[model samples]
Target: MLLRNVLLLLLCLVAATPRSWADDGYRLWLKYDKLPNAAERQAYAQGMQFVAGSGATPVLRAASAELQRGLSGLLGQPVPVVAAAGSRTGGVVLRVDAQANAGGQPLKPEGYRIVKEKNNLVITGRTDRAVLYGAFALLRQVQTRQPLVGLNLSSNPRINFRLLNHWDNPNGTVERGYAGSSIWQWYELPERLDPRYTDYARANASIGINGVVVNNVNASARYLSAEYIGKVAAVAGVLRPYGQRVYLSVMWAAPKVIGGLNTADPLDPAVKQWWTAKSDELYKAIPDFGGFLVKANSEGEPGPQDYGRNHADGANMLAQSLGRHEGVVMWRAFVYKANSNGDRFKEAYEEFQPLDGKFDPKVLVQVKNGPIDFQAREPFHPLFGAMPRTPLVLEVQLTQEYLGFATHLVYLAPLIKECLEADTYAKGSGSTVAKIVDGSLDKHELSAIAGVANIGSDRNWTGHPVGQANWYAFGRLAWDHTLSADVIAQEWTKMTLTTEPAAVRTLVNLLDQSRSIYVRYTVPLGLHHIMGESIHYGPQPWLAKAGRPDWTAVYYHKADSIGLGFDRTKGGSNALALYRPEVQQEWGNAQTCPLSYLLWFHHLPWTQRLSTGRTLWNELATRYYTGADSVLWMQSQWAAAKPALDPALYADVAARLQTQRKEALWWRDACVLYFQTFAKQPIPAPFAPPTRSLADVKQLVQLYQLK
Candidate 1:
């Protein structure tokens, strides 16, 4: 009886251990370890018999290894690595050359070509790194179950740099990280390199992200020291195999703090020499070192401005250090003064536009997607195409600082897509933000797009399981800004989990509607940052005081008995003048403006009637209710599709959806109750009265100070 019980116990233990089919989301979209269907296994087996590629560049070699590992696991067969193409064996050929091979059209350095030959397929590129990217692309199609027959695709990156900026400190704590601790085990790095470094590289490579900023933009001078350089080199070495280069966010005062210089002025010859020497030393440690990222003269950080120099002076000085290294400097334009005299929204444009044509060719001005910080919703930044002569890189935040953090399932692709698709009209009618960013509008040679990373040391990478989708979506959009959010969501859903057509449809609809739903409940119809003061987690529409005037919630909502919303029209900030006349015309009028953006553009009276036939207060109340109500629908949809998913994973998301639903109602109740004081009106019929008094809500907000 003891022997029989022991055997049964062993079987139970084995069964309970997590499997690839279960909810351990460590695999992300590269879930090749999961068992595959018989037909897929056979097709992949026949198509990936062996891998052939060019000279052994680390990038190319890594690509070959990844293909073999992914193919062997998915198809349950060993895939041989070959040096050159041989008699067609229904395998793949990876070609890396300066010129196209086999009569194929030539590819750009960052471009790739994938063509299906009789029984074989050729993945070719103009360079070894390009071939690496092409390999990942080919594998992605297979992982998503796309038909491989008659494959003839040629692709290139629209942006020159697709990068992730990590706001992590040297102490291993992430500044705005909602996920656990920082991913970089900084204290043990350069010697105790973790295997997770390679895993990080693999995840990034699969999605076409090629660069990483290793520290916070609020930088510490220590990263520039010799010790940190060695540590950075170690991280770079792991990333090198995956075709990724590591960039550092430098403290502008590094010359004084690290190099023993008296002053760190951009125009100072000694300071310039110190930086040049530092750059040389960095390249020696890591040959493929991406250039520096700088945030100066903003929020008390030191910069060229401290020495009475402008942004161009600071950027140009750093650009000089990277001379002939094929490196580029990204200068952040998120500057605003400590004083309250000027409008905060116009600060970045005011600072950068005049410096146009003054920056070095290798220096790209990095602008946020919105004029303000990454609020749930705001007008597009005026700087997108305002400075035609400058090379600008659009910076977006994947971290949910103003949204609900890791708690809310906000699919940010639509938000990203909204900013990219907005018409800038810099050159003419068709000069959309996409064209401006992709370099087509101004013909700028250097273009880039970046997202502030939300990654951390959580077991699943991102804290929330679904937060992984935002990272995946950013890379897909970065690779090709024109890809629709719906298409990307569907592809990710199919590749990362069950490929049941019905379940895919449900997932796509959920993701497609998610961002707008979040906005509706949290800060609907152009309502900007009203989250709780410091942590920025939940709603605090009544918050009226902060150190700075613009930092308070009431400053943005501008709620009065007459109306709600920020007025940036002709009579107010006149920010509309920054856009083309057509844009202004569309947004300048409350009667004609889109309802989704009505509050963002106009401060209409509460009694004004909207197209929906509801008064402004009534409409606002309805939107908050409807938006929160959608969370229930999302929960139901996810539940209905649960049978097709891993039980553990399904239950995890199901619980999160429950939390989201509860919080959504909290946001609705709190915002409506608070705003009612200004509107001086009763709660509309059917919407319940406030569960707590206004003073009780204030006490509830005070409890959030622990964060």
Candidate 2:
């Protein structure tokens, strides 16, 4: 008893003593841990002795504060902020020069230039916001352990508006969010501001993201009311200092629901007047509010279609409502019918393609990267280069709604880059989705790109710690589409995980191959939309029933005794015709089509030979088996990286990788077994058949649904 009491006293003393846990990922890539290299730390500290910039401007103040904070943390010493660069031997200076040039190249409005001016490094740009970005760039260099001597760097955002579309509701639940509750904290906003809001802004500003839509597209009318407008204004106030603007996703029925109007029709003058008044009221509350993101006439959301009007009519009304406010309306083109007999892939193109030049100048038709929803691998949306007159906002989802949620480590930069680099051939061979999205091809002044955010109230922001890489990758790519996926992966690995070369290379290789690894295991060879119904968790290739025909998995794969794959060519849905003739020619013929997209455009027999020299059946089974096995490789690579990574972060990913391997096996077994029933073939030699029968897999699906 005396020994137990002594032990208890020791444990109590241990608990009372102060101790610091390893990184919980709350700081994200901006951890700013003290530099381990003594030489580099001394060099950076000498170069950043003090920060000189305008303290009057909010953005400049933010830049100066961030420079001081970052440099202090990195150098293990406090850095001073001074009023002027005046005679400082080695320091950082921030200047706003509209005609600033770096390496004889002109800087865009939001672009920044960092060059050595005398003994000090000068970060100059056209606007205060750009100066802030330049400051972050300098800190990124230090964080990534890049050489700081004779630094010369210039970067311009290819897209005019880089935004995050949050699908959070007022009640604090995030739709399709794998992380915890919504970050907005609607119940406490307006009266109490979370310090997290500032950190969120800081993270966004570091990556050149300038705007955020605070609500879901399936919006609630309550957000438009005066009570909620105050709440939004409070949130905007927190973000404004970091050069970020707040936007709203408005419910089309707000006038009827909140304004007590008889009709919510866009063409109706009362509805128009109500919107104008509301817009003006919003501007009054938050002077720099970004405009509305509308999901009209899609997915049972009340829209102008309810009043016999088109998408253009609805979008134009909202644009007019903005009036003198410096904002633009982004109308989503992710529309399809519940009871349509035609190909769902062709529906959005058919509905919006005809009204190409009809939209208002301030209207941007927000098109998903793919024709369908954010599938694992989709051909670039046909509407990208088709509508020359209408500016398009390319929307991609960062949330892994269908890509194994938070359990799988699927790096999405490659998936996003694939769509951006696709040749549309709209204006000949040079036309690409990137060109269309940046407004260079159409020569339009306004352009934007949005990523459906995966952020939440979780300590790590995204549910999976590595999921932070996707958010970082989206912002980096949105700023400069020319950056390679490997480069972004390496940069992120260094900033967020480690600076060791071998560890960085291993992490980069893992990230570079992760998306494809997921694609092969889950939905290989261009197969799309075969995930579980509603929840979209695991494989359900046999799903033939749902609320709507298009929602069913079988509606996409079309696997039968004769063949498997969706046919979008002339002999089938003819969706390929939606693209330019050049693109159609490239993807139209099954015999010459790339194997990656072979199943997307044609249905081929199981016995047919592929370009890879394997029968379709054999190739399918091989991909399933090999993809599942790749998870083990990912686990091993991650294990190799543990020594260089934070213990908490490393263990977090290792546990998730185990979950990924199990699910990958589930996907492989379920898909292989289900498809085997149609192929009527044995698992090829050198590969074993799944231990679970088709019925057993179906039972698994039911079990998931029960959860």
Candidate 3:
């Protein structure tokens, strides 16, 4: 009886105990733990005596509360919030400009400036939303231990609309999400507002993302119903104060499915009226409704093409419906057919190029970063420069659908930077994809960029703790494309992982090298779309049959006895001609082309000697071997920085790194052995061959598919 009583006492004590600050990754990069260094704390605390601001609105209240919470935690003392900073020095003041252009140089609607004025830090902006952003920036500087005495910084977003396209469903499942179940509990949403929603909005606003599309592209008609609109309004209410506007992905045939219409023809009078009425209802419930993102006529989704109308017809119809409201239409350009004859790479370009000037003023054509689906590495899409008259939204995937998902530590800033910095050569050498998307190249007022979100219902927000860096990087780059991937990585590492100098440098280097290492093992030398079927995980080079020919790996790689690679040159599909004359000149020849893109444009022989001074066969084998081995190097780097990282966070990543290494080997063996069928060559020198046979690897992959 005494033992039972003691056990009950122990259980009660455990339940009552609060978790350690470093025990979970729930805080993300917003961690405001007290500084370990007394000197550093004193320096930051010197300028943060009090947080002076008015809780005039939800946004202002959020900013003030965030500052108080952050400063109190960092300074190890309560930082009180006051209505004003009159006669007070060493305090932070929030100031909003009644006139946007009243300041000497006018600030953008969402721009912020932090300066040292009269011995106090002043965060001034044209709007309350800007002040909120300024608050987060100040916290960032303090968290990174940056000096604040002489601080003067001003920043604005490069694109007009920076949005996260969440492929979440109403049924609590995320389409391509690697993290757990959906964060939005549709069943409990209208009545029970989860506090997580507020945190989600805070994180987004902190990084300058102003919009969120909270549904899948393969949308359902039910979301357009009156009942669902109320649920959406509730979510929008929480996000509105943080400068976030919610968007919905509308099914093209929603009028037919839910509004008792005979057809969803864009030109039909009744269909047009139905959409207009729906738009009015949406705006009535949520006045700040951002827009609609539509996926039509892609992958068997219903579109206006079914009724003998083009993309412009469909987009213009939606644009007309939203014209009465302050909303825009994002018409997707990711449409393709299975019968494209293994040339899906050219489909989007061919379809959208001619309709460039026909789109309505309220329509922004949303184009994926590449012509193909979100592969690890792809040449910049041909449509970027081709559509000179249309405002195109650059859509990038943060979900790692084609990368290693949440399991691998592949930093994606480099991948995004590669596309952003690519020279389209449309208006000469300096014409970059960034310029086109930012509206500077084409001189279009409407501009936008989107990142398919990697967020879900996991405790850490993202499955892998470090995966948060991708989310952070996307927001930063959307605000300013010129920010280097290296700088962003270092900042995220310090803010989210550790602030120690040595550890920060080590983790930064690890992040910088991770994407390339992943590329090498999975799809080196311009290889594309060879991942496993359906799941898009692991290696499946031997996959020959699927529902469509284009869906098969064999259709893309085109491996034969004499050579490997799909020939997109003049001798083959002639897809290279889609680019500008300059791009064609640069990538036209296999001899002068960068090896990174060699196989993309040309099919070379197995024994072909190249600029690297090795046969194609040997070089391919070397990359596969070295890439798999480099995971060991990454593991070593992580272990060396063990002392600086949180124990739980460190252990979590270490276990994931182990899994990555094993998977790397799996990729190497599977690709090397499968391609060896054509090469008929032994594994290159100084690298040991796989212990398992080709059959063994195939059997293992089959088993993985079952799991």
Candidate 4:
């Protein structure tokens, strides 16, 4: 009785101490930070004993450690790990059944099931990796401030494969990575495995992401070399316990570059043998290798088309080599040619819409969210339901390549939801992109979704602290698309920042309004692909020096004395014909078109009147001004809730908002000033003119290029 009283006294002391907890973001949403409420902490402390599996495995050890760490921080009590549970009522139990895994749903290698019994909780799976996933799921519940008792959750990934495509190259530099250098140190990798690799796996596993393609999609022949395969396998071993399978991006010209064969053609017998042998070698090293991601015949990459074959022949040859290995090929459909004749937007639909059923069952054609690359805002791809016989995977970019690097905060769940909710009208009215991706629309078994990763070696994983929300948002939406953006933001805010109602409302509004703000200041009214050449970092409204006409910035924005925007209706490129007539009818007429996407499909005159009493030019200028003004509102919203935020994090985010305000002004001033020359109009009353001349803004761009 004396010992029990002393323990209760200790718990009371620990509950009163708040500064002892660490603030480092390495823990992410799995922080398991202390519960502020006294009643909540006492309830969680009731079931605090640790129970282990029968055998000691690497994955089981990890599950035990994570639970210990989480419960210690959350319950304000250090729960001891034990080998068995003996009538310990209200205590946490980790039971593993090697025999009980026989009959259940067909599990993904990393899938797990967690159930609550009369006095215990069972975290089990067909394999040890599943146990590890269960541990993370339980931690998520604690972090999200949900009741842990009576928890009976069994979650398997809806998509068969959820992977991250890194644009890292053989050299240390990442193609568009804004966080820092590539995480993979190739020169030291086969031997000196960084401890950071384990932390990376933990972060990914916590979010339920199961696979990673570690190299650039633009293929490099060196990755196929035997020495580099050893390096890749080392990374795979670290991720294995966390249930993540490693995939590779293969060079289509491996036969010519690495194998020393004359041709890498799919029809050639020797080329076929080379790829088979190479795949066999990879499987020998890493038995559970996910599969290959091919970028054949896109951009400047070589493919089977060089030898008069199509994507079907190329994807099938690779899929045949992985026979019964439990893997599949992700053939990217981001193809466009150098031809100056046809519309570039209509090319991918024309090319792959004809070869739907010819692909192997193991092959999935990965299409982007839009017909083009990751633009700010775009209509849903017309190909979502164009091919009923083949399986398709939706590829969304989490990296913020087009949304403003890592600095600007744009919660992407809404953007993804916008695309998923769009009705394809392929079979009927209810056929949405979400149904097509989840395998409910076309009735195909294979279905998956991918996000281009934004992770790096930063202590927080992503560079900007708020950028972590994008990564978190992607995984949450990937698991369940029906979840609302507001709900996710509220959950993440409660777990990651503060649970104060004022702070939660402020953060949610900032996220909900963020994407529209970016679109307004950057690419308002559906104008697309006008970012600066190659780097695509900033604005360039006057670029006209690219090889193809469509490749230039001037093509999409046909600005002169008369009008602006690309005309893709029946008279112009006719790209609208790709969608069903129901979709076409809504977007076909310029006057009745949705205001969010009006400029994307039609070239309207500056003097033409809009639905509002204002002229087209006045509306354009107003949107730009309003976009800049919204940043001020965001700043004020954040400031109003500052007392509810941690001082360190509050200051960090405050500093970033200042930068955002300046950049927003830069965009508004530079774009409006340059376009004013063509429109032949004043800056309009009440709105001030640009501080600098148009020549000065052009010079600023020139100086950025020099750097």
Candidate 5:
């Protein structure tokens, strides 16, 4: 009885003690932890004594509130938002003018200028939303521990529409989502707004993402119903203050599914009227509704094609429905057939290129970065330069659907930059994919870019804590495509993880090299779409039987006793013809082709020596071996970051690195052992063969499939 009483007392004492908070990454890069350097804090506090701005507009109020909150947290002192900057000294001032100029340079509608004026800084912009972006930029500098003195920053989004496409279903399951359940509590939404929704909006606003498509592209008709429109409006209300407009992915057959129409053809008068009324109802519910992202005639989703109509007919109909609503129709060009008679790479180009000028002015052809699905690496889609008459939205996958789900630590900035920097050679030598998507090459007004959201209900937003960087990178690059991958990595590292120079250097290197490492171990030498059937988790190069021929792994790699890789040259599928003559010349031949993409366009002999001076088999084995081993190097780099990082966050990444190393080995052994059957050669010298036989790897595949 005495011992039990002592234990109860001890429990009481433990409960009374204040628990230290763990960094669960919920705050993301906006941690705003108090400045470590007192001198630095004082300098920032002196420059930001108070925020002077009009709190009349919702976006202005949001900017003021953010400044106050961020300054209070960063400086350990309250920074009030004042009505005006009259006679104020050593404080930040905000000004909005529709035709504002930054240092004698004309500013875009959403452009911002932050320059030192006398003893204070003035953040002037052409619009309230631009001022909000300037506010975030100021906070970013403070968070990165940069001096406020002599600060001059001016920026504008390179692309007009930067959006996050959420592949979330109404029932809470996110398609290909690795984090926890969907963040949208659909059943409780219209009446009960989750505070997380507002936080999500703040995060997006801080990163300059102005639009969000809240539903899956493989859409549901229920989102168009009156009750669901109310729920969507609730979300929009939360995002409006942050200058984010909400969009929905509409089902092509919504008229028939929800509006009781006999035929849902784009040309049908009744169907058109039904869509027009529904769009009007949506605009009435949400004033700044961003419009629709449609996945029509693709992957069995009902589309105008079912009614003997084309993509232009469907997209133009939606654009007409929007009328003068200041909205757009983003028609997906990711269509393909089940029949595998032709190269999947040529399908989208063939189908969409011909009808380029047919799309309405308000319609943007949303093309994936690659012609195929989002592989680890892919040539820039031919459609980027092919369709000069149309405005194209460059869609990239931030969620690691085909890459390693949430388990692998892959930084996507390199992949995005590679595609962006790819010379399309559309008009001449200097034309790039970035120029095409940003409306500079064709000189079109409407342009957009989208990243398939990696976010979910996880406390960190993204499942893996490091996955947050990808979201951050996407936003930064979307705002300004010229920023290098390393620059973005360093910025993210300093803000999210540590300010220590040594740790920052180490983390940046890790992030910069991560994507290449992932590509090496998983799909080296441009081997694409060979992941496990349906789940896409692990290596399954031997995947032969699937519902569709193209769905099978063997259909892509074409491995045999002679050699490996798909033949897309003139002698094979002639898919190279889809690209320009320069691109075809660059990638068509085995000798001149970049080694990274050699296997993608050619089917060479196993004994063929690459530019790396290694035979094909030896190079493949070397990459598999070294790539798996590089995970240890990443672990070491992350370990060196512990002293400067949040303990909880450091430990979280360390644990994930361990998982990554184990999986890397799994990928290495599985691919090498399985491919050995085709190469019919032993593992290269200095790198030992995988002890596990091909049968063992096959068993692993079977086990993963069961999961």
Candidate 6:
């Protein structure tokens, strides 16, 4: 009891520290540093004399408090929150009126509009949560130094449920996570609510992410217990004021594992009753609990398939249990057979397409961005346009599991943008993946997009400083899918780093090119799933054995003496048939297909000439060599921005770039030399031959895979 009291006291102290004002990335993009120009600061100060609001509810109080905190720092003055501005001029007013609209523009639920009323700046929204978002949007204007006059900024989320799915385990380990440990303090929770929880909630709410799944999909049933429910309730309380809800990844056999039951079958009446009871228990603990995220019959997890039932049978059962509660069941569509000989890229489509209109209204079939696991680059999943009856939640991985695991300076905005902008052709030429995800393509009411969280216990949040850009980008893009990757990168850079023109342009350009550059060195020409064994790092093209054949590097690459790519065309696995005919027409012909995706659909001869005026082997060799060399250019760009960036922040990224340069060379040498044996060609011109042999690279990879 004494020790528990001490822990609770320590948590109170941590929560009282406000925001970390250090040069570290703890503040994320929310840093409200004083404006560098005093003239500009003074002008902005006039509009923020005092923040006026009722503080009637928790969210209302939160809005006024944030305005005070943000304006106090940015203007270098005391900006107090008051009950009312009364007749005062040149003050900020926050209003939550059901009839509020942005000037003449309309607002969807949880949307905000900022406009100048009389002489005061007014931020209004339809709901208290909308006003809270408005509060952050106003702070964003000051932090980015946008003009305060003539304000008519109206913003609404494109998707209904924007979320972050944390692959955090109950025991403090994070699956595929690189930053220190899990941020969730499981042992100290329920009694000791860390201040960091509030910070995490604010960061998500600021960018319009409305929900978070707090446990790993490869789940344990312990999270569903009465004891854990109390812990989750404490977390929900902290997040509730910010309009974010707590979600759990449920173990499929929770009925058997946590509750005493005969069989964990969804159709079993006893099992149905168990879930109904469980849902009630969960809502009683956390009234606004966001529903379950289930990963079953994929990678050895238990599921409805084990009991002679399909995915719809399982998902509908859980959705029915929610009954009158306002929640959703996100049933993951990432299923693949353990020992199947079929192409893994075609597996999810083959399985889920048959049950398109069969799902309950409250269920969403969450699909990954690509057909396979989160490769550096992949053709958008066929499931996007293929499943019109079921509302699909696009699940993207933010953790750099396959993209070098937080060490490489790869910006994932480009990767995500590529997938979003791709034409699914489900409803015609302009039927983009984004349209399908936002529910406009299918005319479905429910919509969502989730990013597998990269966040952890690191003071900087993400291990790599630039990694924060991906998190910010996800939220902005989720709120509005039409926002370009370049625009998002520029916005994040100006707000997080310096607003100096030259430095901002340089950093934005670097971020724009980082994903493609990483792809060129590591997995160029549509290469997929060839990373090292279980860790999914470095290069392992020679890897041929794993527990499952599909898990081997050799299974996907299919490199041979005659060719160097997977044959997904009709002549091979016929995976191209899964896409619409228009997409097939565009991707079918090797001569016309985009060079970036040439290898994904077809396997060409080593000497076959591409439209780039280079043979297959030569183009592959050039990208590998040039990709590694471009990391040197990235190092130079970072060095040039040193004058504009914070010293500690600049140093951290500079050091990571050094490690990235080393590992990029490792990827280049390992892949080039290994593939050379099959190509039987010299290294292309403007590129020197690798100093090391393929055997040498294989030995190094073997050592990396050692337990």
What are the C-alpha RMSDs, in order, of all predicted structures?
4.6, 5.7, 4.9, 3.6, 5.6, 4.1
- Name the TM-score of candidate 6: 0.97
Write the residue-wise lDDT of candidate 6 on 498-537 in tens digits: 8999999999999999999999999998887889999999
Worst 10 residues of 1 by lDDT: 8-17
Model 3 Cα RMSD, 1 decimal: 4.9
Model 1 misses residue 49 by how many Å? 1.7
Instruction: Say which prediction, candidate 2 or candidate 4, comes out ahead on TM-score.
Output: 2
- Highest lDDT, which number? 2
Select the stronger candidate by lDDT from 2 and 6.
2
C-alpha lDDT of all candidate models, in order: 0.85, 0.91, 0.90, 0.81, 0.90, 0.90
Summed backbone clashes in each candidate are 0, 0, 0, 1, 0, 0
Per-residue lDDT of model 2, residues 564-592, tens digit only? 99999999999999999988887998778
Off by over 4 Å in 2: 1-20
Q: What is the clash count of model 2? A: 0
TM-score of each prediction: 0.95, 0.97, 0.96, 0.93, 0.97, 0.97
| Candidate 4 ranges with C-alpha deviation above 4 Å | 1-24, 54-57, 95-114, 124-130
Query: Which ranges in model 3 have alpha carbons more than 4 Å from their true place?
Result: 1-22, 99-104
Residue clash pairs of candidate 3: none
Q: Which residue pairs overlap in candidate 6's backbone?
A: none
Candidates sorted on lDDT, descending: 2, 3, 6, 5, 1, 4
* Winner of 4 and 6 under TM-score: 6
Error of 6 at 108 (Å): 1.1
204-298 in candidate 5: lDDT tens per residue?
99989999999999999999999899999999999999989999999999998989988989999999899899889999999889999999888
Put down candidate 1 lDDT per residue, 326-420, tens digits, no spaces.
79999999999987654688789888899989999999999999998998776678998798888889898998888788888888999999999
